[model samples]
Target: MTGSDPKADLHRYLQVARAAMLWKLDGLSEYDSRRPLTPTGTNLLGLVKHLASVELGYFGETFGRPSDEPLPWFEDDAEPDADLWATAAESREQIIDLYHRAWAHSDATVEALALDAPGRVPHWPAPRNEVTLHQILVHMIAETHRHAGHADIVRELIDGAAGLRKDNDNMAPGDQERWRNHRDRLERVAQEAGRSAAVLPS
Candidate 1:
């Protein structure tokens, strides 16, 4: 199928992205999953960990899906972005399974609830609270895609693998090496311009 129904497209895109992220992590040793991809320490598996928590919030907690399991890694008191990293205690398999389980729960919620169903974001400021499931679905789709992009880069860093599924041959035709070169050139141009002053101070 070229395109899909609105909700189905949005949901399936997210699901496929999530699956791609997991697939990239496949065959990686535990040590590799925790290795930072950049100066700031963004790891492939940690992104999955973060997304699992996010799915729980947007789909599970938002619609009252009854997520009874204690999320120790999701402690609100933790320092900012702490949840974005994996702990020594967390194995690659465990985090991956948790994300798959999160997907299962989230899909169930998305299916059972209507788009217009009312939901509350406890984290949202109390003065003006509550939003529809539709809003969260949109937000989650954006969030998942954003993280999924991160996963792509991390995967490339892992083994020179690229694209959402260039390996699958379902999308447009293009050479991976040429794509990388083009993206690199664009980045250089952008960075050079970005650091320059407003007047292009030569």
Candidate 2:
């Protein structure tokens, strides 16, 4: 490999970000990680479960090498948000282990396939025909990060531990007061938008 191979560079950045996302859950108690953070039951452990399925599908099935393991849910018919919470019989450790394993297998595909390597996303509405490893990678990055956010909030609520990474390397750069003000501003904006939407003419 060259001293700074562009291919390796991109992959490394993606891998780093992916690891940071998972690391956000480190050291948390099982109950806390699996606790329903919202009324719809979006829990950290459940996100991990959903991610495992996504990675397996995008990387494995896309290549005509779908996994043989029994999917955690939606095997036949899926509830609207069945993938957003843990099943009564599923332990936190099992879900987490499966997610990590999915990462290993999915990343191996990333290494084996080229950015333009063709994949078929049978579920897409229009392009229901084809895709590529690059597009899938980007989609996965977004999905993982979205769920990692769920993990972040849940973790913080559990033990006041909040960060996008285990080492807090990706956290804010300023004082706590400034951060609070920023968050408050965001909250106010959201509230205002909600109120405005509610009051709009029918």
Candidate 3:
């Protein structure tokens, strides 16, 4: 246990989350990749674009190594939630390439700094703004994984595809018929539970 490198472990998890996010875009058409699947417009390529901005800010700007590339959506004059969705001009390949570049920059930051290396989050309030590489790593790992979960759902909604990764979906092995039956069972249980709740005394 003692011999295990904490940084390496954390980095590995981050990388996995990153890979999962990108994998969600696989086999998707341009329209599907940019499709606003949710009411608030959460899309696959948008997720990638958002993560790229997150990594650039947390790993680059927060540590005084701001990215050489410009992120227009982050500007003060840009429309709200601009980073959350891609425009028509922003090609899928362009956003994906940006994400790859962000990974390289973030990896470099992880490599160059020690776990205890101090940094400041400009947008964070009060003393919370002060943080270390370890804290940022943990924060980013959680952030990436959270968005990856969103991607999983969005991708499933787009098609029937669902899983943590390509090689291993991390889902129960079952045919479509079995899945439909399972869903029907859950719906029945939910309706029964709702009826039971409604019948209870206030």
Q: Report every candidate's CA lDDT.
A: 0.80, 0.75, 0.95
Model 3 residue pairs with clashes: none
Which residue runs does candidate 3 get wrong by more than 4 Å? none
Per model, state how many residue pairs clash. 0, 0, 0
**Each model's TM-score?**
0.79, 0.77, 0.97
Candidate 3 per-residue lDDT, tens place, 47-159, comes to 99999998999999899999997999999999998998889999999999999999999999999999999999999997999999999999999999999999999999999
lDDT computed for candidate 3: 0.95
* 1 versus 3: better lDDT goes to: 3
* Highest TM-score model number: 3
Q: Model 1 Cα displacement at 41 (Å)?
A: 1.3
RMSD of each: 4.0, 4.4, 1.0
Q: Give the Å error, residue 138, model 2.
A: 1.2
lDDT of 1 by residue, 1-202 (tens): 5755666766887777787778778777888878898998989888988988888887877778857655677697777776688888888888888888888888888888877899888888865458887788788878877887787788778876666663583445668887778889999999888777556746
Candidate 1 lands at a TM-score of 0.79
